[model samples]
Target chain A: MMHSLLVEGFGVQNWTYVLVGITFTLYIGIAIWARAGSTKEFYVAGGGVSPLANGMATAADWMSAASFISMAGIISFDGYDGAVYLMGWTGGYVLLALLLAPYLRKFGKFTVPDFIGDRYYSNTARLVGVICALIVSFTYVAGQMRGVGLVFSRFLEVDINTGVIIGMIIVLFYAVLGGMKGITYTQVAQYCVLIFAFMVPAIFISIQMTGNPIPQLGFGSQLADGSGTYLLDKLDGLSTDLGFNEYTEGSKSTIDIFAITLALMVGTAGLPHVIVRFFTVKRVRDARKSAGIALLLIVILYTTAPAVAVFARTNMIETVSNKPYANVPEWFKKWETTELIKFTDKNNDGLIQYVADESKNELFVDKDIMVLANPEIAKLPDWIIALVAAGALAAALSTAAGLLLVISASVSHDLIKKMINPKISEKGELIAARLSAVVAVCIAGYFGINPPGFVAATVALAFGLAAASFFPAIILGIFYKKMNKEGAIAGMVIGILLMLFYMTKFKFGWFGGGTKADWWFGISPEGFGTVAMIINFVVSIVIMKFTPETPKDVQEIVEKIRIPSGAGAATH
Target chain B: MSEKSNAKAYWKENIRYVLILLAIWFMVSFAAGILFKDELNTIRIGGFKLGFWFAQQGSMYVFVILIFVYVRLMNKLDKKYGYDA
Candidate 1:
């Protein structure tokens, strides 16, 4: 087999080069073959994508490097508290399928701002939508670029800056050349690559730990070593032995978890890039079906994540706890060279103590390295380790390409065609789209190379901002005919400003930088989106009562979208 | 039925379905997974605490099922309303 041939004599780094080369070639080939020819094709893949293909594309677009690399890693450390992300990220699709996708598909627009501008009958609302989309997409994409760089620097042994530049070039080639048509197909290929890459290691580790091939089931099964103790029971025992919370017991406040989960779900539904995927499908029903398919595909990884977390966490603790630094495995040293895993012999004992106590802890493991190092820790073959690098790249690049599309579409389509120069020709607009794409990729590349101090905080804040600004406006616009331009604009402005004030104050320590105890109603910045969204809903409705009703034709358009009968190709 | 009322009926039924499904969505994720987690954790299936299972695994599976169910229901409604075309 090609796998065996590749693994036979090549080192892990060499295998990474071969596999990454193959996958990148596949993506670029698809881009060249499926290049967009018209504005419609560029914006929404000519509005002819099959449901299944769109589903796969959306899955790839939705699951970023955070989902593939960091989610399991974070879960490994957070234990039961990690359920917030597991439930939060996936639950949003339910909201999308039920409340958003079909209606947006029926509206038949090129961008989220297009829908907002037309639905609210105001350029002001559209401009706000464009700004929000840009902020969310840009913040989200920067993280993805950094993720790409991280994989490259670790696996391929390149400078992180060089890795960023290479990733930028690849994404620029596909996104600028192929547009949505190109991105959609490449993402389908990427989804396959990433899912396979994720599952292979997980399945191997699951069987090795619990004698179960399925990771989801194996996490709840007994240890494979003739120990009758259940895996979670053992993990809980190990955790408490090391001064950590029990594996299955959460430490977060219930209200905070509820708020965060709601924020992420609403945010997922409100994200412009994910919503735009529905516009590519042929019909409203297809939109609904594809949302289902996307979530199903996403759930495959989401469910396995906690399991991988358990296995990796257990393996890591057993391998390093109280063990001599000299006896540590080669993988630990390799990661240590990357500085992601550090062992400081504070006690001068030369043994690695990985206890939870801040004063006594000797080993510091960065959460981002858990998934990347999982295969190696399990003694898996070099090829599987290389496949993970390729997978992480696939995750990062696909999401970056998706967010770049949103950024460019918000600019050329929303800012240029709608607001700035309505007289622009289709050809002119397509050129504008391509040019903005190039510019967006450059900016995204810059951020990747030189990430801002708040890149991580901003990525989470992107969700909060989306949930704050977009979800309420879109929801009221569809469900309530009385929703007017004045109401939505006011609601969005206040919601976004409130969310920004809260996030910056808490997350960035700006605006007189408050601590966690100062959080409003005990809701953390991550979960503040729920409060902002509720306020937006209330502000929109209350203002709508005092303001003028929606114009007659706009109400009729709302009626049309509700029926879902004729979801034709998206237009300008 | 008149077109106006016909559209209204379709939308109303759609909203009803959405409400029911969203209720299930909330039940699994927020209620069982968070608010009532400690209560549910008292019960265990295999090595999994019921609430922890819901939070980490069961809620996601239910979410996928909910979406597909919504799709199926909406598709049937569209057909019934003669909008499937």
Candidate 2:
């Protein structure tokens, strides 16, 4: 039946429409079925979600379009330097499980700020948490919205802006109606769709190139062509031939790699959306189990990514490097129309030169195109390509909804209920939550359409901001009973301000815009978060020493959170 | 044991497990994957250099294992402290 549909002129775009249509309808249906009836359900899925389901939802929420689409692409380009993301991202779960998640679940809060406010005994700290969450989440969401636009523009042939608007509407519909309840189940379905779509192409290509079905092992095995050459060895040779660094070698300095890895790990632990997922589960033990399950699911993709990077990089260079322009395959031409792949034919030569030298190279390919173009480059089936489209949308939309939830929760629960309108009723707060989600979606859409100059730097900025602002506060709140509100507030303000100052100065060339040579202690802005984090720790400790001790009640709250029993459920 | 001291004991044991687990985490990612990567790269396992594999694949696998191990240890601790409920 499927082959007959294709034979009847149902092309890639048609298949994409069908798959995406089905998935979108499924998401909407799930949303309506699971719509939240109260503030608790909207905020934390009523705090009765099973560990297995929560794990799946967390996995889907964590792996954004960046992970699904851009990670492999970036790894394909950066080679060994890209290890920071792999290790950095997955490593954070260890910290989350061990250091953060269980205790936060025990605290039984609706949001991160709720913990901050109550633990520190101040609305000021909560307000700071809210601001930092908004900054990190909004910066992160812009990239996701762009991912949605990129997929729609390429697959569905819609205008990028139109795609952003469409994505905004769909996200608003589900996020507002179902709240966290709807988002959780929809994300579970999305995780399945995305992982299947990601793996099928990877497995097919792995078998074709290396005769191994497991992509992780295939990347480390000898090629299938009986050349007895290892895949990585062959890629290294190909890279050097084009004047590029050896495929397995690192060009980034050692300290920068360490800093970047640390920053990402800490940032991952601090992300409010991911941390909030644990609050939905029933017990402290379930929180820990669910975190483990989430990481296990996430690693399935994280581990496969490098292998996919190697395969796609090797395949891309072999197909296009030094090849005649006229003989370029159909996929290249298709991508050319999207301007993601461009050929200028320098020196009036018909051959495509993809050399590392910028002046001499005539083929310019966007790194974001590698994963989307991989199946097509390998001559996979049309439905598989369409599957990638739907999968990309699933990844983007799930993460966007998660972040939007955090945004709305911050506004309605933290800012309005806790700060502005403490007398507001439960029903009023629920309405406020939904309305804030609608407004947040619009702002996210605007950024997606007219992305800021720093969109490319967003991952670094978001993670860095989270690392700098949230990690120290939460960790201190949990582990140190004496940590007072003054210390926490001062540490966060200084930490975030330091990160922002460094990022804008280095990334945007603000404040007289120093170059690479002037980077403090040879750390890039991407890695500056690690330094800022340490400073937060030091400042927090020193300030705590000089300031008044935490009140007896708040200290007792800390003692209570440390114990795993009696975690019951997350409550306001 | 008194309730306050019992809680303290549980907390202390939990911290010990975390520190040990976090040490392994640091060793795998920061030490093996980054600081000693070049040294480890001299050794190869099939097509993968030891260090590069650790950076890209091995450390992540270790991290997953570390979490589950921590979970097991914590669950045991909870049971011992009568907090399993």
Candidate 3:
């Protein structure tokens, strides 16, 4: 059962052990220090976390397994066009901090539902928020668990399914025991490891290729080989020569990409798991500070990704081109066999041009594999590979735990307790939350076993859903004074169901495998979510205008949320 | 009421920045991807066409830098309004 890589001198066993030891110890340390007590502690760390610490945790939370592993891989293949995720993800934080974070913090809530419920004065609005939160969190978490399985399988030498089951157990243990307080502290540690792991490879690779240790600048700078062309430029040239769109241009319609980017940007601002992080800070000022810090940390990774993409592409292309397929390195052959890196051997020359030949060029490699495969491609030592394994696992496990807690919260906090049993006790609700986390993990593990094509695509679907469903409600609830209960709930339901229908119909042919011709308004599922977002906003505004005025007390609430006045020392 | 005028000025200033920033966002992604793509194709800044690079790399770097710029500007504005924490 030993994989060939394990057989080859990479003692993945030792490396994996080191990785697990460090992660387990870190999680344990965080749990003991940031112990939870009241339900508030479980929900939002009792609003006492420092801006820097919250920022660190937020960075880790925001940069999931896909960002760590697949971003560069995607960028390498996607070229400059792939910058949407990088830009959208990072830029969205600015919108979040300026427009959303401070007000949400001042609202002083446990979850997004808590904010929506209190704001609209309706159980229905709370329930709708809960449903949207659950959908977005679950869809995102499933991918994270799958990422854990992949990393564990590679490093621990276990079957993927076993790796997933083990991951589920570890995530469940910490999440149930510590809740937000425990997860936040653990995530701080995860941020350090994931960023260091990401940068080390980039740094090492940059030094080798560009003779520069600073990866951010070096990637766009000229290659060390003195070819006069920057690594990025060379890559675009090489790729386009083979008939691919220049790495920086669009092969798809511009409108679609524009729409998708907007959706992702808004979606990031509105994500329940992400927004709820603001509640963990002590005050509105702390929330804004935390947002700034989070943006700072995220930019480091986000900026470096484009460089990593160019560097990785240049290096990968150079390795495969013009070489005899047999004489290629062992990893090349291994990847080829797995169909991760396929060559058509055009002209039967026994060499892969790896050019972007539109018709005949079949130099197809799963873009997600690029980041995971980097250490091996560079022929770095085995420990780096093991370190990567650990990094990917941390990225996956940390985010998965966060998402599952949110899902379980939606069910226990917003739906069952509020609607079905308003009389539910704190203890009973707590127990229900724990049980829900376990069930949710099991379901996520199932999807991990059968991950849908490309992690990025799945994540995009999650973002689109959030943009369509929760974003309008949250943004409107904060900015508009007149938004009412019925309007908010209806907007959420219509937006969510419409987005889901569009996603399923286009992505899976939900209603009898509809063809492309069946697409509504030529909008792909990816773009449809943005359109749905507009509908929600317009509908909410128009309905609020027509409806009777909000309760007189509602103005007081908005006034309270805006003022950074002396609320006295924040009591946890 | 005078304070309200001050707050209104602050709001207008913020709006101006947003409008300018939005233009950059559009030019990088939408304009580069659609309208100006062919124009960018003529200029090879290294190995990539300018338009393609904008879509993938240029816009991202600008976004990161913009966050810091906004932060700096907002901090100054906050101090002006006595809102600095």
Candidate 4:
């Protein structure tokens, strides 16, 4: 198994080690090249990146380790229901481009809270915005670090804790030194590495399975083994035979899925790390164009994910179903060592059985392992395996760097400079930002070593929190000129509290365990955010109607921002 | 027309474009992908059930296209309004 691969001097581990070393050096070099010299550069890359480069960096920032590593696995296991993620995450960009990005760019802010603060003209609203940003970004960074740890643990044979620490150090080196200026350029490089790594194995697997080189088309193509069956048809039949839902159909309640998808869409638009990227662009037009190009770059991976899921699912069934345990492939055995995949002879038979019914199923595979183990499962060359390892690291590091930057900015810019010490000098603020990044990376590393939840689930909570809290507040701040400070603050507090209450009540059983039946409208905790967001809108509109009008100056600023003109240099 | 009227008219046109684009965005995802998914699944496209395709693949493509379309339409609108950067 993996031991054999490790025994050879020029094996997969060696390749992975070399590639990771080279990639890390390249990223650090970029960081050094793009090093920040001013507060503006530290926060927003000196507001100078082109549309295309910003688009690429935004794509890298948006597509986290969860998207690269676990998305395909989730699709494979969850069947058609997983489409919620693909659509929800991507469609939000449309909302960003049309509704938020242009106006925010015209406003010319350094951070998301800056928009909320100025729009509402309230320090309290600004503070609330910063809290939400920190929570969402911190929750998200922990998952990226865990993704880094997982890849390192499997490929380098390091303990997960050591892997997390190593990842933290590397991110700390680039993120603290380079700031947004450094992180932005490094992310573009990471995007190239990660996407190349993602597509290679997918192309190989597709060619092997259906003689189709394009993974997107391979899923719908006929089997290459003369089976005269569409690949999905084969997977559907196999799934039904194994007591699983049909591959192209869903079994979850439609309402729940709908709510979750909506939550994720708004959440994506509301994300601080993503919103802040738009601030780094040179002009309002670049902001609009960048959103388009970012989605296009992102689509390259998002479109391929379902195809990878189909191939992995079909290959796994064909390879392992009804097979004797002793004859299982090396990849399965290797994954079993990590306990991500488990097998039991339930019927006292030596064969493994994978089925939907727990009583009859003999194999238990964690969904997160699918992407990490995919290249090995396909029996691709050692170099491809090494590439996948490097790609996963790139995905994890790129996202972690973005999230850490936002966290640092929230601390240094929003909390310290704006709230606590308004007179803090530019040099002092830059020092605080770098210091906050170091501290933030340390906390994120701790969470990576002791993850609060599974990678995708923890990331989902972050999305839900963002969707409920920030999305409504910011959208109202932009689109509803009459939305006053009182309405904005009230809506955000109520939205976040309701979401936290529901998640804690359901997810952790705080104030006693709440069952699905106890769920209001039968909405899952993941979907509850959408409902909470609705409540936020209702409360804000109602409160705004009863309150005094927004100040004349605030209304004038809103009118000006909507026009996308006079976007002079952003000032402190 | 006064400069104020020009800005006002331009904002109106911008809103119209956004509404049109967002309508398509909503239909493809929430309608074709979810509400009409069962009916769409009754139809097939290559190896894909139509609803399933919209859910996992089709909607995302439409999203990307919509944004780019927004970009193009906005660029024209910006030029007309003398807001081109």
How far residue A508's Cα lies from its native spot in candidate 4, in Å, is 1.2
Candidate 3 chain A worst ten-residue window by lDDT: A563-572
Per-residue lDDT tens digits for candidate 4, residues A301-401, read: 99999999999988898889988888988888878877889998999889888889999988999999898788888888889999999999999999999
Candidate 3 docking category? acceptable
**How would you encode candidate 3's per-residue C-alpha lDDT over A36-151 as one tens digit per residue?**
67566777777788989999999898889889888878877776557668767766776787678877887777788878888999877887788788888878887887778766
Of the candidates numbered 2 and 4, which has the greater DockQ value? Answer: 2
Q: fnat, candidate 3?
A: 0.32
Instruction: lDDT for model 4, please.
Output: 0.91
DockQ list for all candidates: 0.93, 0.92, 0.35, 0.83
Tens digits of lDDT, candidate 1, A213-322 = 99999999999999799999999999999999998986788888889889999999999999999999998889999999999999999999999999999999999999
Q: What level of docking quality does candidate 2 show? A: high
Measured over all alpha carbons after superposition, the RMSD of each candidate to the real structure, in angstroms, is: 2.1, 1.6, 3.7, 1.9
Runs of candidate 3 with Cα error greater than 4 angstroms are A1-13, A333-363, A512-522, A566-572, B1-58, B61-85
List the candidate numbers ranked by DockQ, top first: 1, 2, 4, 3
Query: Would you estimate the TM-scores of all the predictions?
Result: 0.98, 0.98, 0.90, 0.98
lDDT of each: 0.92, 0.94, 0.77, 0.91
Kindly report, for each predicted structure in the order presented, the TM-score of its chain A compared with the true chain A. Answer: 0.98, 0.98, 0.93, 0.98
Error of model 2, residue A431, in angstroms: 0.5
